[model samples]
Target: MAAQRTIDVRAVGHVAERIYIHDSYVVTFGPDATSTNLWTLSNDGRRLDHLKILRTLEEPGGIAPIVDTERKLVAITGRSSGPPELHISDISSGDLVRTLMLYGSLDDVRMPYSSRLGHALVSTRVVDELPRVLVVDVAGNGWIAGVAYIPPDLRTSTDDRPDPQFGAEHITDDGDIICSYVAPPLPDGVDHFTLIRWNGTPNENTLPAVRADLSISLVDGDAVSVSCCLPFCDDALLVSACEAVQDAIDTAYSRWSVLRAIGLRALDTLWTAEPVWGVIRRLHHAVDAGVVLATGTQNAREDGGKNIPVSFIAAFDDKTGALRRLERVNHIAQGVSVRLCAATSDTVIVIFANGDMSMASLDDFLAHGLARDVDTHKVATTQLWKDDGKKVVHAALASTSVIVATQTNLVVASW
Candidate 1:
């Protein structure tokens, strides 16, 4: 582990809300609290470069930004008051290449695994409407290549009652869009949750009927539901339920089966087991590091006038789903959450809501979980700012460094 070097970005004036680290450049989004701008910072954090600034429209999602390095293109969602717009920019020159206006509000945007395809998966929903998934070609004049609509019957009602919403899971490397919807039980005793895949074709502007690709069933009555069904590697679908993480596989042609299911444990102060209340926030696959999972849980017990919620980052073997490395941090204050976790070549970088950043060595963590001894598994810890008022919203990691973004500034620390 290298000695910690901190670069305080609060002096930069603009609020840096999102951070992305590509090959040699670090990209950040948001200027002040009200303005939407993108800036590129050097890896060492010594230099700040202005990339692009949006003066006309508000980026309601802080650009929900996605960057394709090979295509040199970046896409971000604009404000949602009127007809929504998606902005595409050139990463190299920071020029606004094009803007895509849609009939609905853009909820999510994702680039395919292969940059050669030059298309992105977008999820949008009109006012009081169900969600629709569209395939957009960024290189081909930003045309709508294909579209898929969620079934009306399965869509959540717009009423005030608590309803299950729809979300896009993942876009496969081959450009297929995987979507999942959670539905509450009807008058009868059955729920209508489904997982669907929208096959991508070259056809343009055609809305294809939604097809349910996989049928999921809750194993126990206590198992509330399943969500975040995403494609894992090249074969399996990684899914998270209220209490478990499952790997769904295709045993036969188009026949899916749960190969392995692992139950999650709630964070307990004492050694006694508690009811599971944690939810899996995100899952990611690293180069040679297998699968990395992030989970969040609110502590139910009141301890010393504080209810401490915690975030856990664990690594599992890709094939066996066995635990490799685990680390958990307690958030002592409210509104403090884990913004992002990135797995680099040998280190796991975690950025929290209070602007505290930490790194753990992969080898050391696998051998000794969360060792407190600074000489063993821990790398370096740095406090970017004193005020927890400005939250750390996003983070990304390169092979050698990590960049974190707060509502007011961007911090770059080298490992």
Candidate 2:
């Protein structure tokens, strides 16, 4: 294998709300959410060339542009002269393909890579009416395939409590809508949040039936925290579940957390792994790479409440959970959190909160005996870039390169 090469590209004045990357190109959303610029990598993979300016929406609505790299399309929200609308355009030609007027102000939009062409789930809110989620088909002439209003039970609150709010909502490729709703605390004393999945496509004037209520459906009946749940591969959800326990030694309450992969459609546990670190936090589900990468942290209890941060890069076989390994990441300072992680098939790139970057090999494993005997082994890694608090805005991993972007610069490291 060739030695890895790191290159720094000056991206002054190229700030963006978000960045999306493919193996061949990179797309940056305008910081003001008005336009998007598509950039193609140079032949030597060291520089980025301006491909074309993709003007998505006609009017600014402060809606962030969603780039679907798999479909080579960009979706944006606007309200020029009529109702709030969504615009779909091609990334290559920058040609407007379809425009659909929405029911009200667009609150959020989610597009699944495997969804039908020009299809997405959009949430909108009206002045006096409750929020509604609409299934939009932007092909040819725009049309609304279905609509689902917020349930009356979830729209109101008790006299003493505040109104329940919706958290993260996802629309799967099969038209399954998964929403997280958090309600006021009940007498049970546990967090009253539920992960609801509506299976099947919603038809005109009819909402799909709810298939699973994940809050009370698990074997242990522990509420799955939506903030720690990650949607994976359009069909699976990576969940980090924590259950309080009474420590026998200290006679105090402690928490035990485990990571599991749950199939959204079948409503089954695909696989589970217990990390030595008790807390599972940041997660990356790289389906294309066939591995799930996550970071686990635990504080030291013996050191007078001082934190001994134990951060590990765990790799798991996505399908069968055949290969499970916990490797400690070297050189990360104490109390510095991992802000972003991007993984390809063979490489994993991590950026710390302090603007330091490191790359590790996912394919290279420690010897079987050594890994089994030791509680944690370090993955061989290379320090690609470091800064003293410049702050990484976003990062994306492609087949041949990893791109890290800060407010003032873009760095490309390729092998």
Candidate 3:
């Protein structure tokens, strides 16, 4: 007698990997949910089994996704923005299987990471005048899985290269040397956007003077937003977007008035004018491979030419790329223009609406310690600081959309 539900499960969009105690099977993400490539779910939201990885126009793209429900298998990683192909899909029967052939040029981006014994790390952007770091390794039986082609510039002499267990190199303080990149996050002299470990040694792979002023001009550069993370191995979490945003923060009334009280020395002088971090170096997991996560965001560079396209996030490595916590978010009468940057996890548990919900720790979004929600004004939950011991936060509820659980903190995405 349990059949007449009619179809209105509160509007829909509620997939679950366990939100607390609710699993009716809502795995939605079709209908171009803002532009597909949503997280290889398919447990019951319908289909795509494992790595069907589709957005197709003929070789489509969005790589960095896995489903492996004990090997039922699902690893989708796609990429196709006009002649840029690197796809691998096999969601039980979706097809495409294997296809990799990608190269990069200019303000390039290709960051996606994942691990937990699955293997899929891709870091692209090997264009030099100065800006290089190309790494690719994808193994999970779709095939071409392990060639280990990471050589754009890490100044090789080869001792098998890449150490520190795996993320080797990143010795900032004034020595400069962070070779363990995850890709798509450029322009660095290092100040506060890290996922490092290179303590010394740099024949070439640059970027680490520590910002007085760097400029790699993307112009306004699509209102910069960079994210770096290497969750556990010592320490690495660097988020940058020093603010000078021209447009597109995505709403919330322009991220609450450009997230007030800003200071990043004019975005580090547009990321040091334009050397693009000397010459790239991102070879995480060395070559054996295991922990990876990369992310990037852009939309604030306008010159009538407008080439705003930088959105990459390879996953699984402490859950998601190295991002501890950092929130600014102002409120200029809900226009919510553009402030930039948002990655959460450290455990946030919100529910609020007056019913009240609070659970914070992402280290209080660093430097300030946010708590706002004042009846859903936003930022429902935010706390991060977990090197592994429990103390996380990046929770959001009410409308739902903020995920990064399993110690990375920032949950609320049942769909």
Q: Give the candidate number with the greatest lDDT.
A: 2
**Which 10 successive residues of model 1 have the least lDDT summed?**
264-273
Residue-wise lDDT of candidate 2 within 1-415, one digit each (tens)?
A: 2344454543444666466675567877665667667888765556677788876555645444556666777666677777888778887798877777786666533333223544566667666554566767754365876666555555553455533444335667566766555554443334334555666555434443553443332333333344356677756888665443222221112334556677886656777665333456656666666777766545434434544444556767778654466655433333356555555666666666555555655654312211221323433234444456576677666665766666766666666
**What's the lDDT of the predicted structure labeled candidate 3?**
0.30
Residues 1-415 of candidate 3 have per-residue lDDT tens digits of 1121121111122232212111211111232322223233233322222223344434323332444344443444443564355554554565556665656531223333333334433444443322333333343544323222223433333233221111222222233333333323223322222223222223334333332222224333322233222323333332322322235443211211111111222212111111121111121221123323222333323344433332222222233333333233333322222211222333223332111223343334232334555675554432222143432222212212333223322233332
The C-alpha stretches of model 1 lying farther than 4 A from their native spots are: 1-14, 22-25, 31-56, 108-114, 151-164, 184-192, 202-231, 235-237, 241-277, 295-307, 333-342, 352-356, 373-395, 406-409
CA lDDT of every candidate: 0.54, 0.57, 0.30
Candidate 1 vs candidate 3, TM-score winner: 1
Cα displacement (angstroms), candidate 3, residue 83, comes to 24
Pairs that clash in candidate 1:
15-31
Which tens-of-lDDT digit does each residue in 1-415 have in candidate 1? 3433343443355556555555665555555435555566566544556666644346545434667777777776676567867777787666778988766765543333336677666667666655666677766675787766656455567565344445565555566565556554443323334565555542333333344422233343211344334345554466554432233221111111221222111111111111223444455566476544434343433333444556666666666666666566555422346676556657666676677776666766566654354554332345667785877667776666666666656665664
Clashes counted in candidate 1 amount to: 1
lDDT of 3 at 87: 50
